[model samples]
Target: MSALLVQPLVGGHTGAAPAHTGLAAGHPGFLSPSGVEIVFVLVGLVTLGAALVTVTTRQLVHAALWLVVALGGIAVEYLLLTAEFIAWVQVLIYVGSVVVLILFGLMLTRAPIGRSPDADSGNRWIALVVSLAAAATLVTVVVDAFRATWIDLEERTGPGQGSSEVTGTALFRHWVLPFEALSVLLLAALVGAIVLSKRNSDAGSGSGSRPGSTDSVPARRNKAGES
Candidate 1:
């Protein structure tokens, strides 16, 4: 506890390991699969499935909805990991706000309500190869970087173990720049959405307000050619 708690940074958590690497090998209970782990696996499968559907669905609205499901599953996974703060933020910021913003963007842009033909790209084979290659490269890098490293979850609850407070502090202190950058990106997205809505509205009004519109009386000269 004392060892991990006083870290300037980087400890046994320096790399990665199996998801259950921190399980105590000296204890029999840790050797057996736990119900929590089973639930975690189920949640992971759901997340993966929802993510696949979100990316593959031809219907834009359905894709957005599946994205909500995927993000919600991620929040649940975070909760299962006991990262309550991150879990709630994921729910509030991503599943709730981001998804809502995306839906609104679709509506404002007058996107297709039904299946979008453009959703399917012509480069299916190329995309499949690129995705597989990327996935393989990531797997190789992660395995090489964190072969046997483990995060001691049991230590985290100890008084001396670094916990949520320490993590939040580090995030705010060391990670301020990235957070600020993300905020800027979100602001840009919001402004872009507003601009898109304005353009669509302007176009609609322009088309509606035609010269000599049928619903309106056109200016005409009397028989003497006087207005």
Candidate 2:
């Protein structure tokens, strides 16, 4: 009994020191990332490239297609983060529904499939400056906020950590109002786009059929009949 007590007092957990050091060494460092980190970085790069092309491309169809790629890449990133539910939701909602809706809207509006000079905006420089500033601010804030936060992906944790059930429950329970509001907002935007397109089409048709226009067959026929 005395020897056991004396050993602990003298050694002062000397036997456990190696275990702690080994565990600390086992934890991966930022500089030496695992396979998952490498894949995540690669996916992020692809997603960023897709997003840039979506915004800068003069072809509306290509832009919408690239937008799908960007949104799909985001879903892949969510999958890599182990958020399966969110990944599927991203794929289904944004990649599937929203992108398809955008394509349909483009088709309905008779938007140009090829390069369109109208797609090139006069305020591009201003938009770029604002985007860069906002990106920088967001990066700074996010980095500062999550500076000390770390997750041990390899370590086993409780089932409640990243499960679909927990996510679904939290989303529906806490975020239902916001989700419904967003759905309504999307509906409104869709309706507005259709209405505006119809108005523009009507104005175009009306202008083309003006009574004084020489190209109008009805006007020419009327004058011929009067004469």
TM-score of each: 0.63, 0.64
lDDT of 2 by residue, 1-227 (tens): 96786655434433433323332244444566779989999999999999999999999999999998999999999878878788888998998788888999898567876889879779999999999999999999998664433354543566544568788788799999999999999899989978977984575568675755435555655665554
Highest lDDT model number: 2
Q: What would the C-alpha RMSD of candidate 1 be, to one decimal place?
A: 9.3
CA-lDDT, candidates in order:
0.73, 0.77
Clashes of 2: 0
**Tens-digit lDDT string for candidate 1 (1-227):** 85567452233233322335545343223356467677888999999999999988899999999999999999999877767778878999998888998999777566787988888789978998999999999999998675444343453444333346766787899999998999999899889979976984575457566754423322221222331
Model 1 regions lying over 4 Å from their true place? 1-24, 27-32, 155-227
